[model samples]
Target: MPLFRLDASIMPATSQSRALADLVESEWSAENPGAAVVRRDIGSEPLSATIWREAVTGGFAAEADRSPAQRTALARAAELADELIEADAVLLAIPLYNWGVPAHVKTWYDLTYTDPRIAGGALNDKPVVLASVLGGNYNPGTPKDGWDHATPWLTRVFRDVWGADLRVVQRQFTLVGVDPAMDRFADQAAEIKAAAEQLAIEHGRAIATQVQSLAA
Candidate 1:
């Protein structure tokens, strides 16, 4: 199956999430050689906030009375929806930031609603892989336990609202070598990082397996 990947990290070249996503994409590409890997980097070139506003406001306006801006917004919404609807499965690589969802990530979904296919649930059964990265550990018993608000929300949007079969792979303690304060945990962080990379490769294979199983 063709792969659709979305990267939502502001650090285009150096994002941990993107690096993990690269493993999945690389495996998927190997499995389905020459297949198109459709991608959109919302972190760097996000859909405008204005586009989302126009889409929402234009929804209430009469079709014939809508302004040119509304028309443009509607057009863009359709384009985004097509990307989702056309894909058999998708991989969304996002990072938890400031304990919440990134603005660009939220915007992507809010605009997804503007398209009837998504809002009306026309595209409800595709499988999805959520590959997320976080700066610090928030696992159970950690001080920051339950502090993550992004993963659960993303889960709802894809699995519940959009009805996509979903799987998640997360890499935490990503700030180990970056922040000076976490230097003490550096050794443990390296171990976690290695494990995360191995998991990424497995998850990538898992997607290909799932898609092939569906075909069978």
Candidate 2:
């Protein structure tokens, strides 16, 4: 069975981000019963501060060249990188924080993209699907809409650093008052939720079908 990795970074369980993630997982699992689905809740397991530091350091260090704490941190980062490399597909549920991805999600990307061994040319040809939920409406040519920084940054990282072909399906303008009336917000949210689920399922099926084709 092929492995599908889902990373959810939303702090609250009922957060819009988690809602999208769950919808994706549920729909995909329903379609592919034998497939392996693994969930990583970054808010709960939260990467250590050292991982962020190592990201700043450029790469991991030798086992014997560091304190026990540092070694453990390096090991965790390596494990995450290995998981990413081994997975056939990846789903990232990103929620906006101050006009960008949450801090932990950014940290995860930092760790994922900084490893010289796992990165460089190794990530070539990998496929990534991004599901982003934003609090405000930033749909091109609005007053507050100009502040959207999530998709662009994600696209650059997936293509430039990870060497992956990335597709982003997003749900934006979730916050109240972003639109004309509050009533419309509920409708839009529900619509976005449905769209996100469908996209996730499509992404899963597409990746699985691709893998099957490769094996043939």
TM-score top scorer: 1
Model 1 spans > 4 angstroms off: none
lDDT of 2 by residue, 78-130 (tens): 77787777766666777777877667877777776555666665667766667
Where is the poorest 10-residue window by lDDT in model 1? 120-129
* Cα deviation of 14, candidate 1, in Å: 1.0
User: Scored by Cα lDDT, where does model 1 land?
Assistant: 0.87
- 208: Cα error in model 1, Å: 1.2
Put down candidate 1 lDDT per residue, 33-104, tens digits, no spaces.
Answer: 777888999999998877889998898999998999998998888988888888767989999989999998
Clashes of 2: 0
Q: What TM-score does candidate 2 get on C-alpha atoms?
A: 0.82
Question: What lDDT, from 0 to 1, does candidate 2 have?
Answer: 0.66
